[model samples]
Target: MADRTITLLIVDDHPVVRDGLRGMFASAPGFEVLAEAADGREAVALATRLRPDVVLMDLRMPGGGGVEAITELGRLGLPSKVLVLTTYDTDSDTIPAIEAGATGYLLKDAPRDELFTAVRAAAEGRTVLSPAIASRLVSRVRSPHGGSLSAREREVIRLVARGTGNREIAAELFISEATVKTHLTHIYAKLGVKDRAAAVAAAYDRGILG
Candidate 1:
């Protein structure tokens, strides 16, 4: 028996960042840098080809963004786990990436040991979030308004506000019509509204829609 090596694909727009990560991982044991990509598109292509155990993804690349890439990977049914390693921890960045099927989210400033642990956890299909991001999510979930809407629920409500039907939302989000209905149900309960119209109005009033 032997310790398994965790394969990784590092995705970042900056070449210097990529080089640094490669070097850092190269110096560590029980890890292998399979390849590197400068943007999400390249990341997806390389992941498809290499089928690495985990992908160290960056959020705001020029050619393609991490959330879109994560969504595409899910749609394509790739088994690679995406661990977002980005500088941004705002709600806008964390929520979408998590909803898009990222296995973990970690800050770029994370210590080497913490990053390694997160990667190992992600490779094992565990969810990981940085302390700041986790606190933000906890506060959002514990908000006084029944409960704050999840990222998918927010997407559904936004579509509802625009008069998009369940079928259209399902198609757009790549979910089934039944899933869309379920999200709407949860959204209504969270917003303290019973119907689509009221839910949309509540979302607007509560500043969740903007």
Candidate 2:
């Protein structure tokens, strides 16, 4: 019959940012600031010990970035939902953090009310992505460059994006060197690239790899 309180662990490298967030949340209803952390590593430790319901995480920190922290939480099998609150919104930043298991993504310029709403949504295990970031993700998924590549071709492209050699990729995927070359050839054709370098760039630009 009573509303449950949502506990939060605020993670940011800046003390002032943490102070502002803490102050704001401390004044809000049905919310509690369980702890404050200056980096991703500290956030993970505090999240493990404090068992907060939600973590307001910053993506780029000095030690062990937010992506790494989010991943560690996933490995530890913690139930806390991570809400990314940071200034960065580029594809390079957003995609990895989301793929790393963040429950929500919001820009720092968000209004106070929207931020509160996002935190509550994240606490409920709901996916919250900023409008700009959401549009980019949707556009990336619907981009024309993706529809032509096969699953195997995409796998090879992903490896290539990571600078993996054909022989190494073949060994990792348990396939022969010739098969890897065939996949690369198809990837090149589908992505309209000439060589591995172009293919790698194309894959990332097309949102096939990030």
Clashing pairs in 2: none
Q: Tens digits of per-residue lDDT for model 2 on 16-54?
A: 999999999999998999999998789889999999999
> What value does the lDDT take at residue 8 in candidate 2?
94
- Give the number of the best model, judged by TM-score: 1
- Please state the error at residue 6 of candidate 2 in Å: 0.2
Candidate 2 ranges with C-alpha deviation above 4 Å: 145-210
* Candidate 1 local lDDT, 107-203, one digit each (tens): 9999999999999999999999999999999998777644788767888899999999998886776455666887888887888889999998999
Give candidate 1's error at residue 143 in angstroms: 1.1
Give the least accurate 10-residue stretch of model 1, judged by summed lDDT.
Answer: 170-179
Query: Candidate 1 at residue 186, lDDT?
Result: 83
Please give the lDDT score for candidate 1: 0.88
State candidate 2's TM-score: 0.71
* CA displacement after TM-score superposition, residue 148 of candidate 2 (Å): 12
